[model samples]
Target: MKTPLSRLGNSGLETSLLGLGTVKFGRNAGVKYPSAFELPDDKSLASLLSLAADLGINVLDTAPAYGSSEERLGQLLKGQRHDWIISTKTGETFDGKNSAFDFSAEATRQSVERSLKRLKTDYLDIVMVHSDGNDLELIERNEVIATLDQLKQEGKIRQTGFSGKTLEGALAALKQVDMLMLTYNLREHREGEAIDQANHLGKGVYIKKAFASGHLVSGSGEEGQLSSFRHILGKAGISSIIVGTINPDHLKQNVRALCQASAGMV
Candidate 1:
């Protein structure tokens, strides 16, 4: 099957409509709350990433908060750097033991430098401010925006964005961002207002938590809930929906959901 790709905001970077999320690579989000469908080891991760690139999945989202996900992804995709698009986050620094949220200019700069080292890349396709709602204002402050702009100018980051929990928080930084990653799924639809605002501003919208953290896929409730959710979001004009799973079967199932939802449209 041919995967569809779309331009991110006004940037030249084009990504698959369904991106691979790397939150489960290194961290154990607990045994009860699995990060993705299948938790592959280092070897498996490398193979899966290579397969994803062959399948034309360009965008891969990761963060420092997701355990050693960024580092693992970097190592796995080391030789295949130019084969895919890498999207990562900053605003928080982790040193294996401690994590401190710092949106200051100096911190942001340091964060990107660390991310670059971890990803084994000179420049990132997109760098998002991973703010947890409370730091929305700090993300929008001149220092933060100026730092991101500088990174773009320096060719260290192609574009800048943010991941917010609320529509208001996303909107607060819309003017300074080229993309917005937020939760918009079947069970959680409150982000529609912010998505509309982002679209109007010509910002790319990358939907996260699209299945409500795997609730729709577990089959504990409605049977066609996942399909319905994808259909609704596709009709609503969302650019992409990221569904991650470590299990290949489950990953294919998620792709099936997307296929069924957009059967006629695509």
Candidate 2:
């Protein structure tokens, strides 16, 4: 089944209900997923993207901290740029062995510029500030949101947002940006109120770690995955759920699960 598109709040952008997360595409050294894995080769990566596109999944999430993900996608999606909605992050960088964050206005600008070159795109659909658990501090101390806003105005990015961890940070981000990428899975729901608020305000809310970072899987197999998808995607506030599974079969299962989950809701 093909994933359907939905309006991303008031950003005037439309993305699929399921977004493919690309962390495993570039960095696997210090990830927090269930297990360590190897990065896909160019051919495998191209195949995965092709399957996603054929399934009608439009959004792809990447970040500077995700190592070479942006560059690889830039190369693979060369002639198919318009086929996907690219969502990447700023404020964090990975140097193969470690991650360093800089939320300064200058850094934010430089990060977006670098991402543009790496992704081989003239304008990004959405640019989110990757929070390091210090959501509020990142917004107030640095030019993270402001720089994104400027970029939006300059037409470099269509929208600005924050992938925050705390409720307060999410709320603050709601007031200043077009979207909020928050963690709201079976294991955590503290951001529930924030999600509702974003819905009411017409701001996009994309869910991260909807399966609790791969720890919420149950013996129900595909049914378990469908349940998790229903729990979050069934909510009216969510724009999309970002799942990072490199295995094509897993990706197909996720899309099918989402289809079943949404179907059951009706």
Candidate 3:
């Protein structure tokens, strides 16, 4: 059976319960994964994406900070642009060794424009602020959110959101953006209240680090994954869990776990 889809808040978008994260697709440096690995070749990525589609995965999460991910996705996904919903980030950029942040309206607009060109799309399904752990200050400034609103009006982005580390920032973002991405998994449930609030307000919530940065996935087994998935996705407000993996078998395993999780929910 295919993975089920649900309303991502009220943005008029429906996303699979599992979203493919493209961080490993673009960059492997300065990451927090359990192990280090080489970047997959183009042929490998193509096959992985093909498998993702076969498994009914529709959402692709990428970021400008993720090295060449946006450009590569633009090339890899050419001609099938409308088939997948692409979510990219702004407000942060990585230069192999370090990352920088600039949330001025000018910088955010430039970032979105560059993302459109890199993704080879005229508009984005979702664009989020790549918070630099300074979520509260950024949200208070309102520069990034304002630019995203202008882009939405100009048909450059379908929805605006924030991927932040702090609860304070998450709550503030929930009030303004159509979507929210926060770290929520079996190990960490600090963002639970924010998830409920976002759901109550009819806003979409996307989960990050659901597998605890792959720490929990190592020896958990499928049954363990099913339990974790149920715990994370069982919440009322979670729109999807963003998992980044280049392994085809792992992808299929996640989908299977998701299907089982959904069944358990019913």
lDDT, candidates in the order shown: 0.73, 0.88, 0.89
Where does model 3 exceed 4 Å of error? 264-266
Best by TM-score: 3
Estimate the TM-score for candidate 2: 0.96
Q: What TM-score fits each model?
A: 0.88, 0.96, 0.97
Which 10 successive residues of model 3 have the least lDDT summed? 1-10
Cα lDDT tens digits, model 2, 1-266, are 89767778977788888999999999988888877788999999999999999998999999999989999999999999988889999999989998899999999999999999999999999899999999888888887888888999899998888898899999988899888898888778898899899999999888988887777763458876888988886578678889987889989999888888877452
Q: Model 3: per-residue lDDT, tens digit, 199-218?
A: 99999888888888789889
Instruction: Give the alpha carbon lDDT tens digit for every residue of 44-129 in model 1.
Output: 77777766665567778888777788888888886888877788888865555666687788878988998899989999888998
What ranking of all candidate models by TM-score puts the best one first? 3, 2, 1
TM-score of 3: 0.97
Backbone clashes in each candidate structure, one number apiece?
5, 0, 0
Each prediction's RMSD to truth: 2.8, 1.3, 1.1
Off by over 4 Å in 2: 218-220, 264-266
Candidate 2, position 215, lDDT: 73
Q: Give the number of the best model, judged by lDDT.
A: 3
By TM-score, the better pick of 1 and 3 is: 3
